[model samples]
Target: MKKKVVPYLLVSPYIIHFLIFIAFPVIFSIVLTFHKWNIISPMEYTGFANYIRLFQDTLFLKSIINTLIFLVIHIPLQIIVALFLAEVLNQKIFLRGFFRAAFFLPVVVSGVVVTILWQQLYGFDTGLLNKILVTLGFGKVGWLIDPKIAMPSIAIMATWKNVGLYIVLFLVGLQTVPKHYYEAADLEGATHWQKFFKITLPMINPTIFLVVILSTVGGFSLFIEPYILTGGGPLNSTLSAVLYIYKQAFFYYHMGYSATLGLFFALIILSVVIIQKKFIEREV
Candidate 1:
């Protein structure tokens, strides 16, 4: 009895935490999806009304598209830049450790602080970027205000903020690749580019998959940059799915509908990750 009881005692904290926090919230959210409640009022069972409304919400659809656009721009650029930088830093270059730390600084900085800094740099009138453009005899380009380019601008900032972590990941992947593979390729007189394509890339497929998944998840969860920089835009161009759900839950007080949107969006994210896994597995 003592041995059995001791095992349960050791696990009780985790069990209690799971039930009180994770399990309860997830179950409650699911129940809320079928009911209408404004937090102050009694929940009224509406039974699919919220889900129906979610499908019909054009703004929500647009927000998902905006997030997808962000991923399309962000993922490829992130992988390329990070992989390139990792390749460089993996060499016996001067000040290599300092360069690695400098590149990773943005990843460790507060995201809110970074976004605010970029906001100033992207300002319409006094922005440093526009000032440079003007000095170079070019038109002042609107980074955040214009609907056409707002999402792209946010994508660029997101890449700069996140590329560091992926750089580290790629660096690990690069180092774990056996040196003898490259040595053998060199014996065959393979060029640097040929060895990179034939040996290095295939060895790091797992890391590439991880970076892609993380970038996709982060892109879907985009909020702070657009929220601060564009406030969903001059014409709702940069409204990410998470920000749209946040608006529904807090701003509009549509709790049930918000819960429904969250469930649906969660499914969408799961589907995307699954598809990504399948596609990469086949390629590998």
Candidate 2:
């Protein structure tokens, strides 16, 4: 009895911490969303008014569209590029550790810092990206300034920052695949393409699924990059759901409304992830 009690005691701190810090805040925030309060005075019950207002807010709707577009652009591209890099690095190569570390280094850095750096890189004049484009005989293009390209530019920056982590994920998955499968494919005169599709891809489907879910979540929640880089500007092309929520709660002091947005955002993420999980499970 003492031994079992000691183990529970050891974990009690973590359990208590999560309940106090994470769970309580989430529950309290949900409750706060349905009532109008200014952190002072008396709170009035508003029922579903906050949620109803969210549906009528055009900027909020635009934010939803932008976030979905960002996800469509970023997630698949990140996975494909990461898979390719992982495949390249999986082969017998010198400096494997160095390359892997180099790729993953950006993921560990702060998102704010990465966004600031990309801002410079995406500058219209004298930017490193434009400079390279000009030197390569391609005309200089406005990466962030042009409304049409602003979201894509942000998406590209996000991909650069995140691809390294996914590369490591895919590499770990790639290593777990049995060499005997490849050997068997070779014995059957399977070409490189055949071996990759028939053996490598199916075996690594789980990793692809993981990358999709993670990247999808990250893309939908994007804020800092657009906030610092474009301010969701260039015709609101880079606006995101989280940024919209931030503007509503902090900038406009509509805490209750913002809470509704948060709840709605959470529901979208949960629903999409569940659907994706079911699809992947069926395929498996």
Candidate 3:
């Protein structure tokens, strides 16, 4: 009896913490999704109204589309760039450790600071990039101000910010390939491209899948970059799903509606991940 009681006592702290914090908040949010609350008033039960309204919310739909667009550009770009960098780093190179650290430095830096830095870089009139363009006989491009270009610009910035972590992941994947596979390919007179396609890619398929899923999740969570850089403008082009949900929750104080949006968005992520898992698993 003492042994049994001691075990429960030992684990009680973490169990209590999980229930009070994570479990309670999650259950509360789910319940809140079925009601209307503005933080000041009592919760007013609305059943499925919040869910129904979410589907018809054109702006929220647009934000989801905006996030998908970001993923379309970001995922491929990230995979290609990170894989190329990983391959290069895997080769014997000068100052390899320094290069690795430099690439990853932006990832560890604060997101707000990175956004602010990119904001300056994207400035139309006086940005360093624009200054360079002016010197090279080109007109200044609005990196964030233009509606059509803003989301793409944000995607590019996001790729730059997160590519280093992917680089390291790819590096680990690249290293795990058997050295003798490359040796056999060499003996068979296989070209670099042939070896890469046949051996390297297949070997790294799992890594590719992981990167895709992670990139998708990160792309969907895009908020700080656009929030700071464009404020979800110049005409709502950069409004991400997360940002729209954030605005609904805080700016508009639609507490219940925000909870509904959160739940809906979670379902979207789960669906996307499941589809990816099925497709990639088939390929594997």
lDDT of 2 by residue, 1-284 (tens): 89879999999999999999999989988997898866566877999888788889898889998998888889888988999999999999999999999999999999999998988998788799999999999998889988888888888899999999999999999999999999988899999888888889999999999899888877877999999998889899888999988988788777778888998889988999899989988987
Displacement of the residue 103 alpha carbon in candidate 1, Å: 0.6
The candidates, ranked best first by lDDT, are 3, 1, 2
- Residue 235 in model 3: lDDT: 87
Error of 3 at 82 (Å): 0.4
Clashes of 3: 0
Give lDDT per model, in order: 0.92, 0.89, 0.92
Worst lDDT window (10 residues) for model 3?
217-226
Which stretches in model 1 have alpha-carbon errors above 4 Å? none
> After superposition, which runs of candidate 2 have C-alpha atoms over 4 Å from their true positions?
1-11
* Better lDDT candidate (1, 2): 1
Candidate 1 lDDT over 78-112, as tens digits, reads 99999999988988899988988988999999889
Top candidate when judged by lDDT against the true structure: 3
